[model samples]
Target: MSIPLDIAALGERAAAMIEELGAISQSPDTLTRFFLTPEHRRAADLVGRWMREAGLDVTEDALGTVRGHWHPAGEEAPRLLIGSHIDTVAEAGKYDGCMGVILAILALEAVTRVGLSRPYGIDVLAFGDEEGTRFPTTLSASAAVAGIFSPANLTMRDADGISYRDALIAYGKNPDDIPAAAYDPDKVIAYVEAHIEQGPVLEAENEPLGVVTAIAGASRLSVTVTGEAGHAGTVPMRMRHDALLGAAEMALAVERIAKADRHGMVATVGRMHIDPGSVNVIPSRVVFTVDLRSGSDTSRRDALTRFEREAHRIAAQRQLSVVISAFHEVATVPCYPDLQLRLRRSITDVDRRAVAMPSGAGHDGQAMSKLCPIGMLFVRCRGGISHNPAEFAAPLDMGLAAAALVRFIERFNLPHLENNTTGAET
Candidate 1:
């Protein structure tokens, strides 16, 4: 017998929990909970308590990942994994990572309340770090669970000079036991994540929920534009080889190349630094950062090539020297087609206006994919605003999303669905 689902009440409760989780932050004014900090510990405790209340066994791993298990009795059965990161970026909105974690727990609770017996158990995971705000590396906790966290990251130190290994020890975690946190691929059937869209797509379509087709691959680069500094008043407009002006031109070119492709390719120059802090001095150098991402790697790389070409062309036109370097990047990740079908059906069950789109932002799903096939459901968030205090998700939208998750889980174990998995071919 399926217990009646009160989506409105569930949404209200989820909204309240999201607000409460945001409150367990390092700062009172903003949500900035990082990996293994005091605030993180408190957040873990609260989440653990919620898991216990939901009738699941809970434990915190060495790397600070909190897991709640709804272990099935009798024979060993495949497990369905649902999760998202608990850590937040600086001044983040309450809904980004934290909302997924809360929603996963609620989904499990709803399943249990319905008393549906299945061959697969359910586990809710809350990863320790996803933002890379405290350290230079991202997805440490999820990578550890995926059995791919590099040991070299342990020696990498933070701004306060605390190595990851040392930080683990300080947090009562044994670095040597990091490998034990990994989940066996054979034991897991699929991984599902319910997250806020963090973009304007769903809102633009006037929908409450959507299914993710893929998570975009990203390329990160640093560029330096160099020119001669001169007296601002004495230098003629044409005589000035201002690096700042060149950088501005290059930035605009980036937007042009990305939007010109017009297939969800995105390029952003988020950071820029100017040399010589004098109001009357012409800038000699400008350092800028580029973050380019797209569902299609070919489009992304082509845009990057054009970006660098345009940057150099602009620099030469202004008689400035330009240097471009690629630093970090990840390959484009595809959503499991089988799981996406289920997610799509689940959304249709809840709301008929469902759209399929690729995520512009990288997520924990990228790492978890190494362990098992992953799928995602994105609830609409207001203004596509995320990583900021202004981020907001309506309670009604969350209600529909919660119902969709419940629908997905209820139909996940159908034998026909298992007999024809697209994951093996992929």
Candidate 2:
């Protein structure tokens, strides 16, 4: 007997979980619950209790990924994986990453109640440290599972110079056991993540949900403009070697390039510093960081090249020395098309005209994609604000997202191309 999906029950459970998590003040903004922190560990313990209450076998991996498994009562078991991160950015909202984990719990509850065993098993993961609040490395736990994380990452330090390995030890976890977190690709049939739409696309279109097609690739550049500093009162504007002015020109050039490639292209100068910043003094040096992103690798590369070229031209005209340094680069990740089709079909079953969209923000699914087929569902966020205390989603919209996810899980089929499950008792 297949269990009936209860949309209301699922929504209520998700809302209650969100409320419980929101009340815990982790940071000044009350959202900076980084991995290995006491508050983050507490959150993990709470989720573990919830998983046990749902009658799933629960365990935390060496890297702190919490796994909750619901095994079918019959033979021919299939393995369907659903999960997302539970950590938050500094001053982040409750729904950004936690919604998916909560929804997964509800999905399992509905699945078990219907006494409907899938042809495979289902597992829910509350991934740790996807936001990388304490350290600069994002998706640390997920990358570890995908075999992309290296031993070098363990030595990475936070702003206070606290090594990740040290933090793990302090948290009562073994950094040397990080290898145990890796997963065999053969065991995972499919990966699914549900997240809030942190952009205005869905809300602008007046849509409740978005089926993701691709995740945008990002490139970061650190630029420095150098010029001879002079006394502001003594030097005339034309005779002055103003590094700040040259940097301002380059910044506008980046904006121009982004505007030209408005087809899903974006550039931002979020960080800047001026040396000798003081009243009545000309800045001798200016440094800034540019973040460029696009859904296509070619487009992203082209934009970066154009921005660099323009920066050089502007520097020459302004008599400034410009240097560009590569800070970070993440290639665009295309979601599995067949898995996307399954998600679309599920969404269409609920609302016929669901729109396909691209995700601009990085996600745990991006890292998981390297190991297995990955898919994502996005719920509309109020005003598309995230990474802040005011980030929000309507209850009706969340309810709809939960419904869509349940339908998708029910209809998805797992491949049997691997022999690992051949000898397993089912």
Candidate 3:
């Protein structure tokens, strides 16, 4: 059972493989690999080749997800799923989504070298639509595996007016086969992913890795304020009812509420529009948007209610009419407590403090959670930068992440998750 881990070697291999995969982008000067494109085909092919080299059986699902299967117990045994998406944003860095797939490959290759035996199998998936830059839909690939994919998604078109169904056909896949991609819910143990922090928390804490607590749920709102128009030059400040001024106060209220709360809530007033935007005219109507996100669903809902009340109060004080409406809402997904503890122990065994944090950004796990308990391990990226070409993670840190995954695999046993329930951590 003794496995010699060459941490530096694993990191170097990860760096090299990331570079190789990143070179397959549609644009030569920058990385931009969309779903079902020629670039996606090449990347998936390369990943499949690596899986074969690592002694795993490789297969591609109908949605073009490349699955590397290692079954030490049997093909029908319950599986420990490990993976991340291979799709990238426009001008993306080399390590965002691709690093997770590379780390899984390296860890499994190490596992294969030692001929480790367990009662369960492992499936390293390389999904291709996480970025959703090509189509109007996102997480369609993972959704299929989780058995939550909607048939209407196939009609969603891209920038070129190409429907998702037609694009799949162009990629040599039949839409009818998508239903077969879902895994039997009874046969899944749990889903785990390793990814960059995509934020500055890990970097600021000076930690190499952290365990995710939950994927933050988000609520987006549109607030509109209405008032009688007045001449800015002639109306007295004490008598004029300005909708823009009332909206500005509501925006401040959002910041104050988020900052005063203890649940790590973040709210942003990212967009605003004022009618008759002129220097000599008082704004008669103002519309703004609020995006609120938190790791606790209860806390988020409470915050929304508070904001609504505060907005009405502000409008009433200013003698202006106000209306609030929600445009988008997604519930928080908590990581399974058992998986979180196991992942933390794995990182601690490697002599690193495992900080527990929530992922503010969206991930494929949000979709995968529908199938089983889910967990995430995050690696620190420079300045917490992502979705841009400037993103970078140290090779040494990546090596440590890979080593941690190997340790996690080594310590895994089927009984640990047999009693675990999905969505039980919230």
Clashes of each: 0, 5, 0
Task: Show the colliding residue pairs in model 1.
Answer: none
Summarize candidate 3's per-residue lDDT along 76-147 as a digit string, tens digits.
999989999999998999888899999999999999989999999999999999988998788999999999
lDDT, candidate 1, 1-426, per-residue tens: 344678898899899999888899888888889887888889999999999888788988879999998865423677788989889888889999888888888888888766778777888999988988888889999998887899998998888989988988988999999989988877777778988999999999999888888788889999999999999999999899899999999999988888888558888899999998579999999999999988877788889888888888898899999999999888777778888888898888777867889899988888888877788889899999999999999988888888888888888773322322222212
Between prediction 1 and prediction 2, the one with superior TM-score is: 1
Itemize residue pairs with steric clashes in candidate 2.
Answer: 3-114, 77-120, 78-119, 78-120, 78-121
Q: Which stretches of candidate 2 lie over 4 Å from their true place?
A: 1-3, 27-29, 73-78, 157-162, 231-240, 415-426
Kindly report the root-mean-square deviation of model 3 from the true structure over all alpha carbons. Answer: 1.6
- Per-residue alpha-carbon lDDT of model 2 for 1-426, expressed as tens digits? 223656666677788888897665575447667888888788899888888887788988777888898877332354677989888887779998898898888777766766664667888999888998888788989888776777787889998899999988888888778877877776678788889989999999998888887788889999999998889899999888899999999999888887887447788999999988977889999999999877778788889888888889988988899999998988887766777788888777666556678788999887777777778889889998999888988767777777787788777665543222111110
User: Once superposed on the true structure, which residue ranges of model 1 sit more than 4 Å away at CA?
Assistant: 1-3, 73-75, 231-236, 414-426
Query: Candidate 2, overall lDDT?
Result: 0.81
Backbone-clash count (model 1): 0
Pairs that collide in candidate 3 are none
Give the candidate order by descending TM-score.
3, 1, 2
